[model samples]
Target: MGAPRRATLRFTSIAIGVALAIVASPAAAFCRSTTCTGDCPRDADGCKTTGKQLFWPGVCVGVSLQRDGSVNIPIADVRSVVATSFATWSALDCGGAAATISFSQLADVSCHQTEFNTSAPNANIILFQDTQWHYKGVDNTLAKTTVTFDAKTGEILDADIELNHAYNELTVSDTTVVVDLQSVLTHEIGHFIGLDHSPDPDATMFAGYDDGSTNLRTLEADDIAAACAVYPPTRSGKCEPAPRNGLGDACGASAPTTSGGETSGCAIAAAPSNTANRLLSLLGLGLALRVRRRDRFRS
Candidate 1:
């Protein structure tokens, strides 16, 4: 049997919901999210751990915002924050040449649910749960990111970002800050790509957050190194932002039903005829257990 698909749950704190061992190289301090479990293999430098590293096969990825805005924040402000968050990564400079990744903002979507469709088009959605945050750690959890990828190749198929506006106070203003929206989204975007938490406590991919702290809004040296390593300037791929099948707007009719095998926190859904045997892995980040509050910073 192939490697079983599974989901990883993380949050902006010291505690990660799942048990994922970080294996880093002597030279680098960042970790890449992998597909396999335990120590399967390693690269020349030992920077990459076992299993295939998760990555988007194409150069460009598309993201859609849910039409329903947050209870406190407007949809326009949310869109602006999302754009800025993606831009922070897209604008990365890998020692002059830019990181080989880009994001395109698709039209607003009506579907608020997060799911992957094997037989239909899909959109990488960003939604806010204003009414209720259904996950385990509601009070401390700020947001959750769900990423779906192919088990064999580690090609990311779909990703979704859900904000915990119901339980926590999420603010978008730069001057007056609570749980900085851009900072939270930027960190989640790191997970959305293929990065695991970094050992560097100051790095954007670090599994910790400071309330009213905007340090995560920009990439640190470690964060830049991680981005450059995963998506180098020489990497080649078409600028395809649409999902596997195509761009989808709704979730009801297009979402596929589960079949075949099952794993913890992952759905064993049917895949397209061309990609039948390959399994898809779904990882959910943002445990929401605790939020470390640091001295507030006003910009």
Candidate 2:
């Protein structure tokens, strides 16, 4: 690809909705990544059948937390959870294995929407939908991660997270019945960074999540290995932990109580593309494919 040109592209992982508490419902499904594949090693304990999708090796990925928080938890606490989730993914050293990419926490943004803008600056945001979770009909989703990438080589250009706060209750406490915000963030961050669900029941990337389980808050062997494969410890990228759009970590504003509105004036969510879908099918992950867009990449 030549000098990157702004293109309308999109990828999505459904987190569903906000719940009052995590009840013992049916087993929750796992995550998916369009960039990852099944050419995986079998020796890792938790890595059983999970494939790998990684960001380009030489860029310091910047993540930003929106100033929105669930009614049940403080926004600052939510930002802390986002930071720790990034840390867990970046700190993987499973013995000698290393992750190629690293993350820097950018400043907080006023926009609580997930969007990639070519005309204006945008932050890779993690926003809480306090009043409404908007998707077709899947209301049970807890959160969703959207990534825009170069479809040709799977080079990630931008990514964002949206937490469903309108339909359910979410918190950062250890109440055991409530959805662990930290645990869900950790899992969603996996998708933000390019990971699909693992076949291993013990893996954090496993598509299956149980209510009140904290295991997903940390990395499993498979999760570590997958991170290592995408970003080795030896790769090169500056450690820039500053917000790209000049927003700061100030929690004075309450996320709007309305059901729907624009978070940023510059971004529009791109729809899925058929070409990307065919490519995912060729990769043996058509069943697990959650995102597809052709303009997101250049051959």
Candidate 3:
């Protein structure tokens, strides 16, 4: 086998958004995340239009909340909020039928590291960075969602959410909140499921977030439309939520260990892409197959 390699991209740019009144139908303005970046000149709303639309090619996807929630919030509270935030999307009404997509919350994982293991089992993790914010613009950026996907088919392989609790106050209450945790998760969840920032300001997938505002806790018309469109009721697939090879809570090749300490050789074929307050880029790694990383930033 070839030696493993790593590639890192520096994200220090700012993506500023100015909220504007919508002149078009709000339901018609939702944006889908593509394999291309924001610079791609395809979507007229400055969303994505030029590349393959990113999506999970299955009916069910698995999600794992890090066992260590956050230093400022209780683990139970974090679990509850995370569950509710994802549930909100799973139960979307697509014209009397449920959307084709569903999520299975695998047991809380001990792995807090954000990565896609090419030669071992993996988990789609949602973790809080309470000790340090490792990205640029620590003060204004609230969170980031990193999606690992197949560039050729636009199929999502693994996704992870990192909350910037180290630099900002994240609250759970409905009133007098500093930064509502549910709102942040819900918006990030959109990115997790392959939705981009919508042109409509009222959408839960909007690019800009208002502090202390819980408006993103619920989906708007645009969000609903986007969900139904992406995962229509007639979409054909089974509800298998296990991550690529299987779910492993640890951070490396030795994950899901037994007495024999065996590991699988299954690697997800990919190319790198990103998204952030909201950074999204596509990264290319030197691996056997092309692996892409996608990320989105929240402010």
Candidate 4:
């Protein structure tokens, strides 16, 4: 029998990516929301854990990229952002025999939607949505990641990410009021790679987000530990850094920018919230601003 499915979490610019355990829940709990549920996989001894560490077949993974970018930025820069964001985790020095993370581009896809198909070659895709933004509650969300895992063993089957471009102007420029596309993707990639939220507010996996911050673009200490714990260097497997099809970053016949050819732009959009400082102090607001785990899926 096929494994059951769990709920998913979506991403946003202002507030994005609350950590989750991919727990089996009723249909009512499956509806994504903006409130933190404080749910995570835990040991019977009470230690926190992810729903499960991802088990990559033969320790290799292939990802598909949408060949297009939102009107706010060029396609080249979008691919660069993805590469940079992914490299942060791939190049980590996990002491020794670590489960090194690596990525290679699949054929660039024309379809920017997020889904998995059993009848066809399913893709682990990351794409941008520039025309329409849809989700429950507020429309300020920046992106969302859908992770499909085995309901029985909690083993991840496939994952996809979608970026919201219609309401927000995204950019790769380091100096700009607009949101940093790389920063947002870095966080979602955490979810994409099977990480849940961290209790440390300063950690990148924390549910709270600080706009205009660049620290998240790189993996923090906590982020590294979570990955290392799952794919430790001593784990039993060979690490291969090549893609299934080829050793290039071309989406289909269209090639993407080289690692050095990163693009840049300004997404002059939302103003920093006046109360951003208060929200940053998640515990200061008492019950109103509780540091709860927010659900980001829609019914």
Q: Which stretches of candidate 4 lie over 4 Å from their true place?
A: 1-58, 238-272, 277-299
**Could you tell which candidate, 3 or 4, scores higher by TM-score?**
3
Report the C-alpha displacement of residue 8, candidate 4, in angstroms. Answer: 27
lDDT of 3 by residue, 105-176 (tens): 898899997777666878989899888866644555577787777666677778888888887789998877
Which regions in candidate 2 have their CA more than 4 angstroms from the true location? 1-32, 35-54, 57-59, 240-299
**Higher-scoring candidate on lDDT, 3 or 4:** 3
lDDT of 4 by residue, 113-232 (tens): 654443234566777878886642123556676666544444455666777777666678888736678877787777666665444344555554445555567766667766665556
Residue 138 of model 4 has an lDDT of: 20
Error of 4 at 41 (Å): 7.6
Q: RMSD of candidate 3 to the true fold?
A: 11.6
- The candidate with the higher lDDT, 1 or 4, is 1
lDDT of all the models against the reference?
A: 0.65, 0.52, 0.66, 0.50
Model 2 TM-score, 2 decimals: 0.64
Ranking by TM-score: 3, 1, 4, 2
Compute each candidate's TM-score over C-alphas: 0.75, 0.64, 0.76, 0.66
Residue 133 lDDT, candidate 2, scale 0-100: 62
- Candidate 2 — worst ten consecutive residues by lDDT sum? 258-267
- Predicted candidate 2 versus true structure: per-residue lDDT over 1-299, tens digit per residue: 11212222221111222111214321222333543334433322112243233364344677777765566788778878888888888757845656666788876677766555433455678888877866532244566766665545555556777776666456677665456677777877777776665543455665434444465688776677667656667767766543333333442144322112111111112223312111111122233333223332433
RMSD of 4: 12.6
